[model samples]
Target chain A: MSTSSDEPAMGAKKVEGAGEPIPPGKPMTMEQHIVDKGAMMLQRLKPMKQISQHGCSFAIYSHDMTRQIETHHYCTRINQDFLQCAVYDSDGSHGRLIGVEYIVSDKTFEALPPDEQKLWHSHAYEIKSGLWVNPRVPEVVVKPELENLAKSYGKFWCTWQLDRGDRLPIGTPALMVSPQGVNMGVPSPELVRTRDLKYNILTEAIRDSRVEIAEPEWLNPMADYWKQHGKGFKIDVEPVDMKLRAPFP
Target chain B: MSQHPEVPGDPTATTTSLLEKATASIQRFGPISHIHQHLCAFHFYSHDMTRQVEAHHFCGHLNEEVRQCLIYNSPEPDARLIGIEYIVTETLFDMLPDEEKPMWHSHDYEVKGGYLFMPGIPGPVERQDMEKVAKTYGKTIHFWQVDRGDNLPLGIPQIMFALTREGQLYDELAQDVERRYKVSFAAEKEKRKDIEGPEMGRHPLANGAGKGLQTVLKEVDVKPPSGTTPRVFV
Candidate 1:
């Protein structure tokens, strides 16, 4: 996680002698020139302050509940409560935009009607379970963000189900939820390995960093309810290893 | 521990360099693919059964026919991501299957009432852009009902949209938004005079003209059962 001091300033190099004006009788096509000019204009007009960007990995489920897809999210925190994430099938620049996830705070979540509430899934499980992780960020930064996210809720819809060979966002939006409880599934081994290799850190290592952060009580609804009522609802269970499956055929 | 180690240099130079680095990173990730217009508006839940919850929308136009909006609770950063609204042209909407039609709501009421706006942009340009948006339909579903104060997202997702007609939006809600954003709906209405409102029909399944089919059917000029003389209209 190289911070500002370590990274070079953006476009600091001086433009060496302005390139010769395009030759009047150049062989280049007009369309090609227009595209080249458009790209430069877009770079100049880009909005900087309006967006806060971060990169992370998400373990998402298929629509038919058959496969667990490992997706990368290049998230832009538009504001404190709102994160409009551009989801990718892989972490590379070549990764296509497969879906988008909108995350809101508890305050915004309550404003929705009951039925609307159901469509969104809680992040408590994802955060508490240590499934959702930011491989790029430092542990210190990731810790607080996870603390905030643990208390937040998200409404995720995957547009591109790559397994089905769909290119564009076609068909109804599926309400994506994180796997719940101890026996819940894990992402594929290949996906995890690819992610781990990219970050140069193990998933277990990231999970270990969250040992001190207090797990929010709201994560387990039944347990929280019973605990509030002073009722003893205890279960003695063994912890199982998180095994990743092969990618869907 | 500081994320960035202090560099051994003049304090002013260090600050400038750091700011530039942060700026550069933001520039690299900020813009979406070919995003031209950024419009800010409001979306309200369509189901009359639920109390009105006003959701602020910051939308980016991907192209002529498609726009993806980031729905928020307020204009500020800490505002929650209540949901996402996908707006498409009439051609796209017409192509959708009949079953999917109910999920989408029209933008007529939102446009005409001046509740939906493209803030920061020029008045004429905003009006022109919104006119195109007004003709388009949106399919929106909000997952977080933050106004309810629930800790977690509870039940099923609810279909939502902007208030379509007069009196659908409360004066205080409009006033609050105007005050917070330092914008005037009355002035916006005046600016939007050039853009004519689209004529909407009583579509069988569509939430056209701001009211849903159930609400319309329930108040179909028929006499109320017993002594309940439609308190909604009054």
Candidate 2:
């Protein structure tokens, strides 16, 4: 019964032509009336709390380890085992919906068949290395949240390969993987610097903040696996001294 | 015991060798490193259809314009690979052929109604993101009707998505997702108060009334491959 005052009444029309003669009044069609009512009703409806409202940022890489992208993830917890994330290119309102990610607990990951399991990537490295972060949250709260996220596994598919210069999402969706071990893939130095400057925190410094959060036993299998089969390379894992860097220009 | 060349005679040497082999075996299973994001959401065969299925989507962002998600039956490890969903912007949707246009469903209704949701996202951020998502469109087809208890993906792939409007969605289906996920649609609806609903008339291609699968099927004049009746959950 309630309605917003701003809404235009159904079938209301304004004459536009200054020189042309006005036409005789025409009755609104049944379909037009119905559509207008539906629109009006929907306008007054409130949003649902089915998904979580919080947004977090992640520095993600391509499946082939070719490019690094900074994405904003707005996630909703479905249950104990699953969390669905809506991915975007930025935290701003104009950010594009680039992809979606699903995070599952270790128990759910284990239940997957071998081939299916291979399609999913682990969050252990991201968590342990502190590459994944909730930069918006206060420092005090972020540690515990990061520790909690450390224990889960995530699978990401990026539909828009912006790096390839495709205006629209075309072709197959590429499977994205997290950086592994000390040898996390090549993230653009400029992009990382820009993100770090915006958040005013470094990945290494964030990683160091959680040095005391013990690694769960579930991570052992994957750690051992990476030791054996992971690409043998090393990237800088040093924590940046925040005091030493110049203030943002 | 000392005869084998690989096995050293010294007690310390033997212990070290055994430790090395144990480490090697443990490392053989290796680390999983391809998938980047995980999402769990509900998908129905058609906007007008009532049957809703939960999907665990493993996705990768190819660029700013496209996201490809591999849909699964469940979040469990044994979850079957049921289908793939390709999400695109309005710019992309407009580029598609008329035939291809009907295959994709607009997110306007689903987002405004709060039916299409990403479960782990917080309410405020999700609302903001939904505004953007509402403008986009998705084309999905499920090869497996796993929710119907079919052991294998039976029959031809059926186009599936979320209901566009309130009455089109069955109460039972909405309740089922709510009960399983410990979420309330009523609460979600309340949280989405500020997001403006899509203007239906402006986007004829995205309109739910004429673009639903039923209407599309009628327009195309094709029956879903002979033996299979489109599964409709009460």
Candidate 3:
């Protein structure tokens, strides 16, 4: 039987210990290992089998465009119009799942309520700038995929802010925005240089090849919540009296 | 009249269609290729039992014991992206810290009660999958509140829970799912009778049983990136 290296091994260790260890404790306990092994043998993880695409990019905090982090996306295309990605801090075997991103076609995005549209950001700039790339796949195999993504929009949420030096996922989830352009002062020169160097590809060369991927004219104005509105949401935990809205029952 | 008031249709519709087709023919679309299962179920807000919404789970396995799912409000091509759920075995769930356990919900009830089903798959095949799912646990957070008639996902993400026993799920909701999918919950429940649940009862704290849990978002101050002067956006 051929085993795919990308597949998480049975009894895989829980992804932890990135950044400074808050409260700094010892490594995984013995009991944790045993339980993981037992679960590996007993459970059938049927949902992870479909991660078909891998892309690397940078994400800026929606509330603070100055704050940025490199993101490794393991995505599963739900259909021609939608794709969901599990965002990690790295592409290594031990990368932690820091957030999730949902990508939809312009057709799907445009249909959203105007207020709702602000939560999403367009991908055209990221694709055309060569800031978003699938490192493992050949350019020929990935271009068409980029072509489709060029006109798409994505809503990203990061549970763990490793860039902010958070020891673990704490506080409320933060919304993330895509890099718009170099002139925007996001996705710094160092970020692009490191990614290109690590992956052995030239961002400028890739950018030149993607000249045909035009920006969609009908792009929603409210999209890119932070940039367009000059303000963004900052999520936090608060106590509340919960009530049920209609149509739920 | 347009079905969506926000979208008046675009003039580039024809060129966009051609570009999509051309890309579809050659794109590898590697990331989404492993999605092989679509399980339909209902999720209620953890804070309120009376509020519930249909969840269409498109899942893929990452390993023998861990699975991740992307939940949609509907099964249609234009369905709204609502939430995400991560599933793990009882063994793994047992390893979680006491405070963390409450965030995860058990699948025993969702499976045995027949509230979960794979649309269009053969009963036997789906039953086998459900049997495996019965002993698992899931943690879900819904970003979009479609039930509230929100066109776009708004507000804070809320943690969600699964129905654990009889009388928790509304009858009308079950009927609506039954009518659309052409599957009887009663028949599915009967068929799943022989399926064994977790050897041990589900974690007591899971699903916020007998307790109210909700997420309320507050506005917080944003700190600049470490060791750098904050750049002000004009």
Please report, as a residue range, the 10-residue window in candidate 1 chain B with the lowest summed lDDT: B213-222
Model 1, residue B159: C-alpha shift (Å)? 1.0
Estimate how well candidate 1 is docked, as a DockQ score: 0.04
What's the iRMSD of model 2?
25.9
- A88-185 in candidate 3: lDDT tens per residue? 77776445556788788898887777766877888988998888988756677667678888999998887655565443333346778888863343
Q: What's the TM-score of chain B for every model shown?
A: 0.68, 0.67, 0.88
lDDT of 2 by residue, A1-249 (tens): 100111112222322333321211124345433432333333211111223333344444322343567776655444455555656666553344565666766766666555445445667666766566554555564454455567777766564455444344333334455555533343555766777887687877767877787686765243212222432111111112111111210
Off by over 4 Å in 1: A1-55, A73-135, A138-173, A179-184, A190-249, B1-38, B149-154, B179-187, B190-205, B208-234
Candidate 3 TM-score to native: 0.68
Off by over 4 Å in 3: A1-56, A62-128, A133-154, A159-172, A180-185, A188-200, A207-234, A237-249, B1-12, B194-196
Q: DockQ (Cα-based) per candidate?
A: 0.04, 0.03, 0.15
Ten contiguous residues minimizing lDDT sum, candidate 3 chain B: B1-10
**lDDT-best of 2 and 3:** 3
| CA shift of A47, model 1, Å | 12
**Residue A64 of model 1, lDDT score:** 28
Native contacts matched by each model = 0.01, 0.00, 0.10
Tell me, by lDDT, which candidate is best: 3
| TM-score against truth, every candidate | 0.56, 0.46, 0.68
